[model samples]
Target: MAHATSIQYEPVAEIGGGAYGTVYKARDTESGQFVALKSVRVQTDQNGLPISTVREVALLKRMEQFDHPNVVRLMDVCATTRSDQETKVTLVFEHVDQDLKTYLEKTPSPGLSPERIKDLMRQLLCGLAFLHSNRVMHRDLKPENILVTSQGQVKLADFGLAKIHSCHMALTPVVVTLWYRPPEVLLQSSYATPVDIWSTGCIFAEMFRRKPLFCGESEVDQLGKIFEVIGLPPEEEWPTDVTLSRTNFPPLMPRPIADFVPEINEQGAQLLMKMLTFDPLKRISALNALEHSYFQDEETLTQKKS
Candidate 1:
């Protein structure tokens, strides 16, 4: 911010277009390090940058001070004026070579080892807990949004992007996958931090299966797929405010988690079930998730250093 972005950073290549705008892989001319450039076009008023943008960026900066190993680093932020009405706000972030989605794909044969998966999950929950404790909710938690360093370190990305993308959400053509969505979100009920836990559960199972646990085409279908495994929530547990009635879903009995993820051990299955609980209020918190028996193995300490 002390200097113009152009003078310090050089665009290396076009990475991909995201919800708000195109992201580029850039090199810090001074540090010779790679960074991702995520920019959003904002409507400008007499007040300059939108209040929401300022607040989110400030939060990101504050988070950087913690130097949390699990969270991605926000390298820098700069604003460029495009016209009288529009301004471009670009966020620079440390570039990780791959994401969990691809990492799972590249696993040599069957899939990740149990110890390896536990290590990844521990790093992931540590990051999530850090963000949650700081009051940042990762409304969208999926493989692609989670970056994995070459050394196998996990760093959460795009944690609060939804809020900053609120104004342009409708205009964006990208449709977020509903596979990781929980019943509460699928039913269009109110949600909170517990939403991320559900996604984490899905990812946890995927680590063993090397594929998605519940592949759904629509919100209704997604709920049905989820119910097929976790079973339909009892009438009293269903959110009263949601238009999607509990009766719409078949009254199914809960299936064993082992049925879906046979590779997971018994303790991992229990923790996964806790995270995928139907009620957000009862769903396990990220901090508690870290302490689950599944992650209590002493091997985790050795792997954590790996």
Candidate 2:
């Protein structure tokens, strides 16, 4: 395989695009390896790279130090010039079969099995553990950020909102997509890695059912959906820094996990409850979560593979 230092790749096709960049499926000319290249436009206004793009580049550079099957691999990064006078910075990542959202939409099978969901949850937890161990918070952890490889392996990707713990001092809660965003974040609490865990729980539910567990239209509505499932957090459970701490949120008791998603097994429900705990300190960390009973079989599979 050609290292990042080598310039050898052939464009395959455009996979997706967003405001900051366009993702292209490409093949390494030297090794014939397929990879996804995210090309971000170079913006300069007498300053360096855009703050968002720079943050992503820096995070990817740091993540490169560690390698895990469940974490997307950064193959390379290089600058390319376009005839239109735009210099684009391209991020090279290992090719994934498709994003989880797309894969779920295309899967012909019925809903995912309990075992398959467990396997994916374990992989996601492993990837989250890697990120949290390095003191990085993947703020935007949703189904779209979860990619499925051609071999059916699940990898965590899309770190545009990710933040290194010390880079910005304490974490700012101004991140995460609304659907998967933790309630603490919505309430503007001082967030930590637990926020990512909360989002992971939401993704786990979505993967199993092929629909968002809490599909709220607005922030208020979103909180309502969460409260509907997990029950209202007691006043004592609210963090000191959480916004509207003094404001009275209704006292809606949490419903049984089985009531909403009966398809989820008891173990899965337990894991989700741990992740969605109102108290961040009480919430299960990814490191501890990897040892949960839901992943006992996954541990065996991992050992067999090793």
Candidate 3:
């Protein structure tokens, strides 16, 4: 890997930061193009590169190889020696104008137009389908991780929590963000690609409602919130052999998607319900979702405009 000092780029501004490191908007000195630089703090001790960092870098590199437009492109990865002489890994990526969270905050009361929502959702599902087909689970699919360019193109970002899924391997249930976490994950049941679909459903609903569908303070509370909307699924709905955390949830009536998100049309509601299905096996896949009537209308509208 090249050292950050060898790279020709000037930091423009600090964009965001978390426990891992800070992200900045920078200009590539050679190409005169703007890019996002994410700096990850590394442990120089015997531990070496963090597993999270390793997984993220590997996944991003694989995505780069495929050059999927819906997924954020990882431009480069370089190591930088800080003033303390400790090495930090920096990831270079195509800069997006804003995240979906900020975009929604800036939109007016009624939220985005139906067409715009459909456009963004289509892009999200396309990216997710690409990831799922490759056997990768985003694990953390939230509004903050979905980037939007000035041209209205949506790209999936933040692979830090992502992992390659295999039937033989058991994954941690404590993966996705609280608001967007699926019922299976909360219930500590073995999950797979459908978890991403569940998060996508939460994000899809948030696009129309401008708020999270299930805002829970704790795991139990989150399950309660989900049950409040969709009702508790009977034991028969889940795999008979596997054990679940909250099997005794109060019997609640499932509310109609239209009643929950009145802004979305009937077709949109139908798709959302399928994505948010209690059973992961029954949840709609990203590719199947892309084929839904909701996006078909968007396709017709786009063709008309052109």
Candidate 4:
């Protein structure tokens, strides 16, 4: 709610940039706290501000009311007039030390410990459960969208691709990044929260393997990679009315989870299996995932600590 001119902050460094805008790490003068300032390039049409920006701002505002720990908090929203008469919208967010991608890259050869991995996954699923309960679907949920703090806390970030889900409506299947996309979305079928679950599963695997589980080169190739590992879903498994682009997919045999990611324990593998199920209806919900046996030990430990 504060005006851009009212805040005094010195840019420390450019953290990241993309098609949307550049993010900078800045020190807030008033609060004396480090924050991330994401400067969005405003592309106004007859309708005024870009819909993506509008949606993101609105969603973040809504999320602020709940103050979920695993969800990134929007500190402020401000705008500045450019020399060219255009306005740049800067979204101030709580600063995070690094993204999951960078953290994984810096992780040692064997990757994070099982306990740490469980904690991260728990936080991710907790955040997702909160989002889904609020009827919001984070369409893009890759490692890059997951933020990590120095103290090992995980927060979900980047809501630009997110949208409020209505049960009666049919959303576009073009959501989510390629590797993390689910089969329903790839087939242009009507989808909902399960799409996010699929992405979460991808992130879950990456946490242990330090690489994407399904690294498909193209959409077709991506589907091939998925089938290569999980095998083609039988016709009975397909949604009754949904039709896929290719009915004659190669009958690749499904490999055991151990073959792809042996580092994870059997319980972790079981959770991954449910998350990666071909049928969206069969995929594990975030709330249910939190109750999975894989997290039982961690839950017990947390309880003991408390």
TM-score of each: 0.94, 0.80, 0.83, 0.83
* lDDT (10s digit) by residue, model 3, range 109-150: 879998889889999999999988877788778898899888
Cα lDDT tens digits for candidate 2, 1-306 = 234423576778987653234677889988899988876555444454457656767777887877777899888877655434445677788888778888778776677877777878888888889888876778878888799877779899865433322233233333335888888887877888898999998888887778888888777778888988888887788778645643555778889987767888787889889998878889999999988887775577889999
Better of 1 and 4 by lDDT: 1
- What is the clash count of model 2? 1
lDDT score for candidate 1 against the true structure = 0.90
User: Residues 1-306, candidate 4, lDDT per residue (tens digit)?
Assistant: 235434576789888763245678899998899988876555455666556667767877887899999999888887665534345677788888889999999998878998889899999999999988977788778898799988888898866433322211133232335899998887768889999999999888988889999988777788888998898888787666556544758877788988888898999999999999999999999999999999997678789999
Report residue 242 deviation for candidate 1 (angstroms): 1.2
Q: How does model 4 fare in lDDT?
A: 0.80
For residue 306, give model 1's deviation from the true position in Å.
19
Best by TM-score: 1
Model 4: what TM-score? 0.83
Instruction: Spell out the clash pairs found in candidate 2.
Output: 231-254
Which pairs clash in the backbone of model 1?
none
Let me know the TM-score candidate 2 reaches against the reference structure. Answer: 0.80
